[model samples]
Target: MNKPDVSYSIFQDWRANRGNIKAQFILSLFRLATWVRSNKILIILFIWYLPFYRFFVEWVMGIELPWSLKAGRGLKLQHGQALVVHGQTIIGSNCGLKHSTTIGIRMNPDGSVGRAPIIGNNVDIGAHVCIIGAIEIGDNVAIGAGSIVVKSIPPNCVVVGNPARVVKVNEPVTSSYS
Candidate 1:
């Protein structure tokens, strides 16, 4: 038997590693919405998700991710509920977000609305983590449960606690998840 191509194998691996079932469903809907919004031909089909968007956002998945939010490939939602991400926020590939995690905006000192957080690749965000403001979370970083992050985090660090302090640095990214 002939072996599969490298690109096909990589795609299969990505599909296999797409977190839980809930995450897969929500991500599918998000991708559909994004595609519908982008293609002028599918503009008429947007009505399917328009009326039910609030219901899906508030009740079903508890996620408020809009089509404008730029989420990269291999995004994982641990619990896939009560997770709020700002429309302007940018998330990198293979990032895992747990329940009740909010990545939103904050008010600046000049009374202006600040930008949302930019999450890096392979970052694991624990449950109830609130990453606010215009901070940039670096790659291969892990934010512990219930962390209130307001500042930019460097790469390969583990941050925890409220107002999030870096507890560990130069840590390796582990692929195992329970």
Candidate 2:
């Protein structure tokens, strides 16, 4: 029998790393709670109307996210409107995503087709950051108040402005969420 190529072998190895994938999922779920703490009011309201929102998102809105989808414990939504994430997007633990943050692939001729944004841990995405395309945001990335990200962000960095420029790097994020 012929052996698999190096690239093919690496792909197979990645596919077999199910344990790592599950660990990532669990971490994401834990992070969500911290995120919620940072934006407790919004989360509380969402909790209060969870049944309705659940019904709408799961049934009426036609936007489907599977139950098995792993998100960290501290996931907080400062505002809970006009927010959408691609199912394939890999969210890291303790990520804070505000309202109107659409992390998905844009369907345009100039846009790259397929694949979703892979977000890193402890990332704070401010309001209205439309992070489209197949981008990878590293850990501890503090996105500015309003920005559009289409490129990869290195770990321990801060990005701001429209089109999202990396104005600073390795700045500490001080959030109340734990």
Candidate 3:
């Protein structure tokens, strides 16, 4: 992404997290860490800071948004509790994640880790949702609460149930984020 787009994304993140102190602090720290890691000279400092970041964000706050995760701008965290995301996961811009959501990689039978999900833009993930394995969640998708998704979903739809079947297609975004 261009510098302007990055800046816009940062601003959008700020807007998304407004009035949420925990989210603001965590996102700000994540941004700082990401910036530090981008610079070769600052990487050493980031190595030192990683422990504290993990302790505070994971242990204290109960959220596990790693700095290494490639998430786009306007990421919203509602409830901001028990939200875990895999490091290799790629989340698109304007995505909203609720509490107790897990976006993680699956374990192979050979005792190896698999790929994380690639969440597309403008996706709204409800609480207690577990999106596992090497799935691709397309743009403008809404996942219902307590859904367990293990497959790829097409764009512009609403999914529900344990296996996360598409309940509605061409669903319009109800939030002001888009």
Highest-lDDT candidate:
3
10 residues in a row with least lDDT, candidate 1: 1-10
lDDT (tens digit, per residue) of candidate 3 on 25-105 = 788777666666666777775588877888988999999999789898889989999999998999998899999999999
Ranking of predictions according to lDDT = 3, 1, 2
Better of 2 and 3 by lDDT: 3
The residue ranges of model 2 lying beyond 4 angstroms of the native Cα positions read 1-54, 58-69, 108-112, 171-178
- What lDDT score is found at residue 43 in candidate 2? 68
Q: How many backbone clashes does candidate 3 have?
A: 0
| Cα TM-score per model | 0.82, 0.58, 0.89
Give one digit per residue, the lDDT tens place, for model 2 in 5-123. Answer: 32332333234333455323322332333333335585685564445434655465433333224444344445445667775778776677666777887666766476788888888
Q: Which whole-number lDDT from 0 to 100 does residue 19 have in model 2?
A: 44
